[model samples]
Target: MRPPKPTVAIISPALRKANNGNWQTAHRWSRFLRAGYDVTLASEWAGPTAGDLAPACLIALHARRSADAVARFADACPKRPLIVVLTGTDLYRDIRSDPAAQRSLELATYLVVLQDEGPFELSTAHRGKCRVIYQSAIACHSHAVDSEYFDVVLVGHMRPEKDPLTAMRSLALLPDDSRIRMTHVGGALDDEYLRAVQALQAQTWPLGERYSWLANLPHAETRRRIAGAKALVISSVMEGGANVIVEAITSGVPVLASRIPGNIGMLGRDYEGYFPPGDAAQLAELLQRASQDIGFLTRLRQQCAQRAPLFAPARERAEVIKLVADALRPT
Candidate 1:
């Protein structure tokens, strides 16, 4: 007889085809967890009538979108462990007013936050159960300080919170002769955002004609771009924990990010490469300094290198396995 596997199911708000952050995280964790567990990925619980739907444990991503399935699994299998992973919207918005989000939290046996400071955002009653797991990526050591254009790359979908247009607008603030160029990756999520990006592409802001953009790529190629960039730019207005920031650090791509709670939490309070969120003028000034000053570029690269080990593949896998193992322990 074959040895039985510990069955684990990962639920997310999106289908595999959606290619959103939650889906991507779910997919990666499920893949990693399969080394010791029989892992399955789904959008929801098929339920009491379906024999195969119940697993030894359930791991749900997104408080609001996956709430129903989380609730159902918790109620159906009260003894089985259920872990809920919180997303960006949950931290800054939905958990504040959404009842479904609240219920999901209430039912969870354990909570996972992507970055260090996320547990503090939860209520005192739920705080003790939270764990911080910084997402990891394969390391890439390529740096881009030599490109003639002094390229600045931003990798995010065209969404409101990504504030995708801010960095491009900041380029206009650089002196007309500045060599800084910008690249905005990821597709626009809506027609309105698409039009805004199109309009900006044709205009003369931030060095006027100094930018190029690509709308998404296969995972392998995206890492290559980060490996080659002079710097990676993150313009998010809010983020729970950015996988791309981890990607950038692992790839040795120094970053210029918006100074939001999420960014500050990841990059450390004293790191110098931050601009106020939505402040195009300040972003422009930073770009100019990074371009013209050799010492500043050196410092950014050194600082990022010091932080790179935090995202190593072995480290993330260890944290994840430890979490799952602890959850399955006989208590």
Candidate 2:
């Protein structure tokens, strides 16, 4: 008889309704681990109950938000494996000051970061346990580009960390003859940010239609739009790793990203497509150059292609499986 498959619970603060990166990651990992283990996902893990089957391993996302669950799981089953996945806020902000976040790091048997640059953020003691698992996306055939306008699409929620207004402000700085039309796709997470985007979109442009804020679209539709655009822009002030970056690269679309650690980690430290975070003037200049200089766009595409292999589905699956297996192995 075959041995029973071990139960693994994936705790994600963001559920399916959230439609965010954490939820997407949880869902993908569940699928990847299903064949080898029995997996379940929940917003919180209250620890094993009398009638419930206990999980052999726990994978929790977002240290601060999932801290309570991590603590309970650790207390309930001290010998069982526990894995904590860190996010942008957790690494760049919370872990430094938040006690709960720090506890999660200390409790975890292993740590997972979405990009290569993630391990460097941890202290020397924690670095040995950290592993980089770059997110993956299946390749999508590029749609026919609309040559009538050089379209640049930015996909991310209108949150403070994303610094979405940078893209909006860049529209006004584009050269008078530049044909770059910017599209912003993301749901407004902040009321003030929504108003700011609305105000920007309301202004009349001397160059006719210059920007459109398309709120949020379905994931499939968003990918199609990304594949069709001339380029994708990621203007976040901070990121642990971004799913949109993987999606854009797999779709054969080049990215113009902020020169932050997360973006540099995914796009390479020397990638030519970086603009200083919040620098609207420099972003506008790059947009103009990409539209006018064929060589620039070609170079961006080549760089993106070089990084595409890192985000392949098979690679991600293998890494995820190995991480879990290592965590569950006897110490």
Candidate 1 lDDT over residue span 135-188, tens digit each: 888887775666567877888888888997787678767888898887777888
Tens-place lDDT per residue, model 2, 1-331, is: 9999999999999988888889889999999999999999999998788999779999999999999999999999999999999978898889999999999999999999999999989999999999999999889878846686899899988998899888888888987777898888889998988888778767877433788888878888888889888899999999989999999999999999999999988999989999999999999989989988999999999999999999999999999999999988987
- On TM-score, the candidate that comes out on top is 2
Model 1 Cα displacement at 248 (Å)? 0.6
Clashes of each: 3, 0
How displaced is residue 9 in candidate 1, in Å?
Answer: 0.5
Per-candidate TM equals 0.95, 0.97
Q: Tell me how far the alpha carbon of residue 141 in candidate 1 is from the true structure, in angstroms, after superposition.
A: 2.2
The TM-score that candidate 2 achieves is 0.97
